[model samples]
Target chain A: MKRKFFSDRDKLEPALITIFAGVFSVLVGVGLIFIVSKDPVQSVRNFLLGPLLRTYNFYYLLIAMVPITFTGLALCIIYQLKYTSLIVDSSFYSGAIVATAIGINVSLPPGLHPAIAMLAAGLVGGLISLLPAILKIKWRANELVSSLMFNYVFYFIGSFVILYYLRDRNQTILASMPFQKSFSLPKLVENTQLHAGFIIAAVFVVLVSIFLFRTRWGYEIRITGANPKFAAYAGIPVATVALYAHFVSGFIGGIGGAVEMSGLYRAFIWQMNPSYAWDGVIVAMLARKNPKFVPLSALFLAYLRVGADFMSRRGDVAFEFITLLQGLIILILASDKIANYFKERRLKRAALSHDLAAQASSAGGQP
Target chain B: MIKFIISVFSSSNYWFIVLRSTAPILLVTLGAVITEQAGIKNMALEGSMLWAALTGVIVSAATGNVWAGFIAGIAAAVVIALILGLFALKLDANAVLCGVALNLFSTGGTVFVLFSLTGDKGISSSLASKTLPFIKIPFVENIPWVGKIFSGQNIIVWISVLAVVVIHIMLNKARVGVRIRAVGENLEAAKSAGISPNRIKFLTLAVSGVLAGMAGCFLSMGYTSNFTSGISAGRGYVANAAQVVAGGTAVGAIFASLIFGLTDAMATYLQNIGLPPELIQALPYVVTILGFVVITLIRDRKELIRKKKLFEKDRAKPLASGLGA
Candidate 1:
């Protein structure tokens, strides 16, 4: 009998690799700060401990996680369908515009107004996402290129709407009129500035988890993604499933945009794409496109963002340092050779053990 | 509308604007063609261009030499391309994801460095950067109508045109080009013939980086006087569309870039005619998407026809064999 160096049945190798990558990136970030900062020790201290110093900073971290969790879940749904749809950015912007428009113009009862506004946002996002899906299905156009280009189109359109139609005449800046106070999301905690959007995000995470694992449509989507030809041969409508996946993902992204803006700001004040969509991509990748892990991943990213913001305020380090760290971690975790090496070795060992067991069993039966 | 069209066609300035806009796209598209020919999808063109633009501005301002700026810009882009290649080839990472991450990193990193160096996050106007020189061809300048179209352009414009011809000849007649195509078409076959696919891919990407660097130099030093954040804009993406529409051919990429440039110029022209500025700004992207759809449709039709012909040949083969027997 041979002693094994490691257990072949361990399923946490990829997760461990990702953790290592994260730690390595943090070290690199620390080194960067050392090179750039005059007071390197203080800078590191602020970067690591600044977010934990005050209750307000912790609340800010929670607020930051609200939109990221939604975006992360959205990306997870789209990735499960096996398409890299970059349309989420456009969907998010369009959702913000729709929500703002509805919130300002459509007068309704208190609770119903926000609900209708969010629904409108989701619909607009879904419509915007559908274009790229149709193009991909009908003409085999590359989704990544088309979606990225569409983001510019939507940006200009959103700006046009804000500057031309919905401009608050008294305000100097180009922005939509402020939504009614009755429409603002209710505060979740009494003292702190937490909003209902965080709760909505958590609910969405659970819903998405159930949607991906328990539903028949989810099963069909998984099958289509895993093997499109086999799904088609089995009478599954692969194209429709892919399209539905895009629509659902975009809808969630729209909800994210609506909740984020309504909960955080008084008016639609963004002049450009706020880039939550890109951040969502990073979160989804970190979670490995698992809906169940989206909350943890989103919280991790939001913590870094808040920590970086605090560091920038207190020290010489810029907030873009977090972006650099994100890029490094993504590259490292996405590297197949880095993350899959241990898993591949374990798989080989398992195969060898199975072979040995089979030979011994066959010899005994023959005797 | 007719008068506007006639004026646009008659004005040599319009043509010059078109040509100027076309230079960056053409150079970038040529790089894309080379990389695609070597079977490597180099989607980090945008990041490479952005970094190159920053380096070009900083180096020229620091050294007070335009040529040194160009060299530094190209060197920066080449280094980025090599890093991308190391990830895509050696580490087996998804090229698209890496490219996206690189773009984000470049955007953030450049601004971070800019702030560190000059305490400004928006533009490099504080730096005394010199622009690339414009050349007025002595003999060509004397001509009446053609001179207006060709003379007094940036030196990079002439180089871009020369690059097109050089790339065309290289792809069609050079041994390295043949080897790259072989590796692109069949990796195992090329490996059996004693060619290393990874080396070819790495070299192709390096060349691609140099071209992207030239485009960046044109943007900062030729098109504008100073480097601004987001200077590359969506030109790198437009170049990708042009390269795809060109079917990875040098001459076709030149023509495709011209079409995109024409649309871009038209958008600017429309801005002068009281059109909504936002819609006008979006024209290039709209045209690119429309052009992509048309190209995809045409290719699909051609593929269908080819398949039908093959089917017919298969049906006729047994009958011909029976007659021979």
Candidate 2:
């Protein structure tokens, strides 16, 4: 009954594109190593296998996956809603800032402290993200451009908050005061920054999936995204759905930033943009906008980050080379023509096999 | 606050700084405008500028010739745009995604190449890089007030102004411009008229590339003495917002760019008042977003009024549902 895997092209197309992009990126990665490395063979091996080579490297890779999983899941929702609002970075960073402020000033019990901080972070992230959507719905402004401008607005605002009010005179670098001891999320492993944040991120992955696939709100969101006018006609409040979609996206992203900060950082140390915004987009694209697959994609992207780091240290290539690979993958994955070509090739092969089977049946005359 | 603002505006140096800052941003704005008009969202402008800036400095340093570096920079940006064109036009890649990918590539590629070459990812200080000269207007320099504001600007600044005139004429008068507009306006219609949409888009992207190249070279070769990593510093992105505010015209780009220039100038002057430096940095972007919203609101109102007028004129006929649009 279910013999054909690509019975729906939509279902199989993303998978095919993902595989193609992965292969292309690997080839490019190897080519880069060949150009850069003195010992190409060793470097190639390290580049491919560096993240899993040792416990230390593997642990860091998991550590890197924590925040991106949050951002990635966040993006999957916004993208599902057909909004190109790139408010992830702002929300993430603002979430961190909000968490930092609370951790420093507010006093609470151990378990409740981090929870309150995260909730506040989510609120701030949601608020920051809601601006562009409001602008789009009310004034018919371009969400993409307006959201981009907001990234800058919030970045400098984050900087001002850190530099002026939260800055620690005792610290040499530009960083906020140390968060309360109770506010710190417990680390899972000794001698590593890998903390309970990963657990939270994992739980969020499930929660978001449930919210997306099981709930009534999720159904409304999907229907609205499928066709806005129809959804409106169906008595769904399209504008409200879009607003909350954006808000939830920002909320999740904000929690991610908070987790990273509360888990690893004792103070707000991000003077520059940590840039999970773009990376989240990359992860979501790789996962094909599925919340269930976000963790895997985030892990994969994290592996690349750690691999590049390990390769840089051990294989004698710069860590920044991974950025090029990311670019190449995005280029290929985003190309509809490349995806269509693969589909056409598959169809042609199927047709050829069908004809051969028919000829064999005719020759045998067994019917 | 009022007196401080007045005093700041009274200084000729303020206007001079405003114009100086406007030069590179204006070029980038112009680049965004042309591509936007050709039905292409050239998000790759930032990448083009970065590559051009990096390559221009590196090649010039290697070749021991400034002109070679300048030309090389333009070539680098053009090649990048063409690559985007090939993928987007031929392979049917999303233009915005392609641009974003290329920007990512440029970020890593430039640094990777830089570290490989000079063993420094931050700045290419080891190489004997040359800077483009400033041009002092002969008669204008002798004037009392106007001289200080207009004269002694970077050569790129003058070229940027001249480019304003050139782009205005090209977009309004040239046959190619008409084709570009037609293709942008309606792709099928253009194809029906025997104009290849791909060709026009490709050519427009190339011109934007050229503009980005000039802007890039200005940052490294003319604005500063050396190629500092991230010298472009999101000017290419801000240019997109400027393009929106500019209303897709060459002349409009100037006023939009000047608004940004003014904000940047005010930020610089406000430093003495002990304003939070980070807030100062954000002021221009905040203004841009505000400007973007205001313009959109104004346009929406105007369109609504026009639709109402159309409905009234056709009172006997059934009112089109598009009136609410």
Best by DockQ: 2
**Tens-place lDDT digits, model 1, residues A138-169:** 99887877888888888998888888888899
TM-score per candidate: 0.94, 0.94
Q: Whose lDDT is greatest here? A: 2
lDDT tens per residue, model 2, A268-367 = 8886987888888888889877899999889889988888888888756878888878888888877788868867677777867776787664454321
Q: Give TM-score values for chain A, per-prediction.
A: 0.91, 0.90
In candidate 1, how many Å is residue B78 off?
A: 1.4
The runs of at least 3 residues in candidate 1 whose Cα sits more than 4 Å from the true structure, single-residue gaps closed, are A1-10, A345-367, B319-325
lDDT of 2 by residue, B181-269 (tens): 99889999999999999999999999999999999988888888777776778788788889888888999999989988999989998
After the best TM-score superposition of candidate 1, give how far the Cα of residue B91 lies from its true spot, in angstroms.
0.9
Candidate 2 CAPRI level: medium
lDDT of 2 at A349: 79
DockQ of each: 0.63, 0.69
